[model samples]
Target: MADTFAAALDDFTRRDWQTLAPDAVDDPVRVAVVGLGWFAREWALPGIDRSAYTEAAVVCGVDPEVTAAVAAERDLVGVAPDELRSGAVAEEYDAVYVATPNATHLEYVEAAAEQGKAVLCEKPVEATLDRAERLVSACDDAGVPLMVGYRMQTDPAVRRLKESVADGALGDVVHVHATMSQTMLGELGTDHDQWRLDPDLSGGCALMDIGVYPLNTTRFVLEADPVAVFGTTRSEHAAFAGVDEHASYRLTFADGVEAMCSVSQTAQHASRLEVTGTEGRAVLDPAFYEREDREFALERGGSRVGVEFEQVHQPAEEFAYFGHQLLAEEPFYPDGEHALGDARALDAVYESAETGSVVRLDG
Candidate 1:
């Protein structure tokens, strides 16, 4: 069997030539960035700022417009605009970033694993539990490192906040309220009928699209998973055939911490989350998309007092933060693993929507 990508670490570290050539470092992992659509052009590209990389590699994509544009703009050696869905991973590569729609996540991951390429897929992993599980099985069998792009988990402030909360700085976990919504009803009216809105592709409603963030964030902050979940999805425009454009949910954790979370594409609202505990509370307002800042609140006797401050790093900085973990073996990487956990939780949420009742995460 071929060695996993991470398996070369010890050998690279123990090389005797390192003493002679002090500048010698581990081999830089090369990756192919698939899906140059809206997300790749805007969000993921900015996060993976081209100038940060010192080595030479190619950027593979599907769209002609995107591949040419990306190649002209960035420092890529080779730009192969090929569809991953049509067997693009036939060539050898170290890693593949599956930036396509949520439905196609599992498909490309399977191909990457078959190619013995490590995968860094986008959020939710897949549209459904079965597909996600298939991806997990494929990667596990191949011994390839599988990571999901819940990039917020890589943020320094977010990680610290999660740790602080986990340490019981807020006494015992109590309640969580989170919201992420936007008014895309105008532009997306004709285009929104695609994979994202289709239940077959999207798997469900807004809860799956963006609401999963608060669900993941809530689980992380509260240090618990839902033992039971109840959710209702609704939409005014009703673009989705059966799924709701807006969804609100109530989750009861095993520790008795209750959370109410909502997501929507029907209205515009700041993506934010607030967590309260016995000792104190914290609020991650503007928490979705590109988070600007976060606020912390401590229980002041009978009243609650809070402080608001800007986040220390830029939006794209999270990519470098994640890169460093894979590059230099940084200790205490909370994001990548937590992203996996969040993906699992998202699967549970979809299951809840399917059954229309409180669904246990394990069940």
Candidate 2:
């Protein structure tokens, strides 16, 4: 936990946000959104409420449909929603959400940082180690927060898992095994391989895309950084072209406990995580992804350990919490700095994969 989080807890615990109207809070931040592609449609817009954290100042996109839809929905008064492009060079908005492809993350993020707006960048942060580092540095220099989309870290279930491990109920963290997968790859166009499928743009295939979850979650549950990594990769689908479709690897912590995991976009859709230690082990089904309706299990070796389940809090439900922190200026998520280190760890994973040798991260 960072000082900002500790301070936020101290400040927000006293506030009556619970009693305040669902729409009411302290001062609202002016929020701007960039890109209206998959994430904006499936998660973001629906996830954000107008009355919550920030008032929607402008919506930016290059696509006609996205612009038309966002404008029609928000009823943009001055600018056409479709007129906005990444970096949104044409117009300016207060806080920007960069939902562009993984490859484009750094450029747009730098723009938002330069524009002096809080940036909520979609995950992977960037395609390479240098890029993620530059984004973090720019945000730091600009005095802005660079938040990555590791939403599961805020989920109650995820919180409980981390707490349990922290309490030593899992004993000295020993070894961990986890997996995250989705549809192998999407077929976009005959000649049009989307940026995600392009190694130059996406940084990595499944490893950075869906693989980030396991990387983030394991670090959360273990409360440690992987000092070293050794791995192998494989690509089953043609979409991978030369990119690896599936990658499996092991991370060795300073304490000597290892995490052996597989990340794939080509296998059955499952987000499973298992942790083993001297005392017992805990398991979470579909661990990294938030599944509010389903239950997750905690266990000990051979024995059925009791696991308490709670309502998974959606970002929308929890976003107001962020607003309260902001109004108090206490810094909960406090912009996007929380996940910057995680992105760096992820970058190291790719470096190890590319070298086909055990790479030392922080050594």
Candidate 3:
């Protein structure tokens, strides 16, 4: 069994996986970041810098001048948006990180796949399930590896939490509660036209943005898919326009497991994930974020035990893991299929919220 599993990994790496670019394994993975927005600048760039196995070699954005300035500042080649749209920029790097607006994920992903470059796209894959499926199919058809940027999947503490639950340490997971909230809109000096506020561009508001963290984390911990979802969403602030400012949803899984999630754009910063089982409960506060340290706690027998992990950088770990999969020819976790599942779930959440009814998922 061990040898067979190893052989499967080898086959996945050699035959099923395409290198980020030709001869990519022989050198540092060269990445062209397709969006220079806040996430790319603050999180992705810093993480790439910290990764010993990857480098940010190029940048592309909607504004050529800003893109050039950012590229120059980072000492990278700046590809024009048109060049990228035309798929001409794919040859310049080993991988492409699509950090563009949610609506634009399909265009960039298709472009990267056509060029046979490995793709690391920011979360949600696409705002809608159909588009997300198309993105996954594009990569599969092109024979290139496609990874979604779910940083928490690479966090050691998060991994340990999932493992503990799976190993029966928590004793038959029965329930999970997760919350991820942030204050983005109605904040001082915020850009309302940044595409995040527009449903046409963002797909949805708070749920599509921060809600996916709780939703995805619940799935990750349980290692199961929800059979049905009921959701409620609200736009409390006028700034939300056509999108939601807050969303709360419940997921009913097989075997009687359930998950409740809340996400908001109007609330103060808060994030947490808690899992309850027959034996004990585990909680991870501030569940999703890239930081140097994280805390996790366990409750059992009228007592609580907690631990803090140090030197944890989720983005850096994510890039390193991707490199490891590419070099070792192994299947990478949190790949496009994983993202597609999350997308479908989120779509159900929105549908349930809109119709004020439970959305039953098809197997």
Q: What C-alpha lDDT do the candidate models reach, one value each?
A: 0.62, 0.65, 0.80
TM-score of 1: 0.79
Flag the better candidate by TM-score, 2 or 3.
Answer: 3
Top model number, TM-score: 3
lDDT per residue for candidate 1 within 1-363, as digits (tens), equals 012112211232132211222234355445677777666656666656531422224456655666776767776643554444445544534667777777777777887787787677877777777777777788878877776666666554455556657766666767888898876546344466567777776777687778777877677656666777777777677476666788888888877889988888777656877778776666666676653465444452455544344454432544444444455544323333555555566665656666887767656
Write candidate 2's Cα lDDT for 1-363 as tens digits.
222123222332132334445456555755566677665655566566633665555666757676767767876522433333334433445566677777777776776777677777777777777777788888889987656666666665566666667777667788999888766443222333567678887877878777777877787777787888877778866778767688887888899989888888767777788887787676777675543343455555555543444454455544454444445555544234446656666666667777877888775
In model 3, state the lDDT of residue 274: 93
lDDT of 3 by residue, 1-363 (tens): 232122212221121233344344457788889988877888888888777668888899988888989988988889887787687756678888899999899999998888888999998889788899999999999999998988877776677777668766677888899998877855423667678888888999889988888888788878888899999999977779799889999999988898999988878877889999888788888787664256787776666766634646678778877765766667877899889888988999999998999998866
| Per-model TM-score versus the true fold | 0.79, 0.82, 0.90
For candidate 3, the 10 contiguous residues with the lowest summed lDDT are 4-13
Candidate 3's C-alpha runs over 4 A off are 1-26, 186-189
Clashing pairs in 3: 13-329
Model 1 CA deviation exceeding 4 Å by range? 1-28, 50-56, 75-93, 185-190, 295-299, 302-315, 329-351
Better of 1 and 3 by TM-score: 3
Better structure of 1 and 3 per lDDT: 3
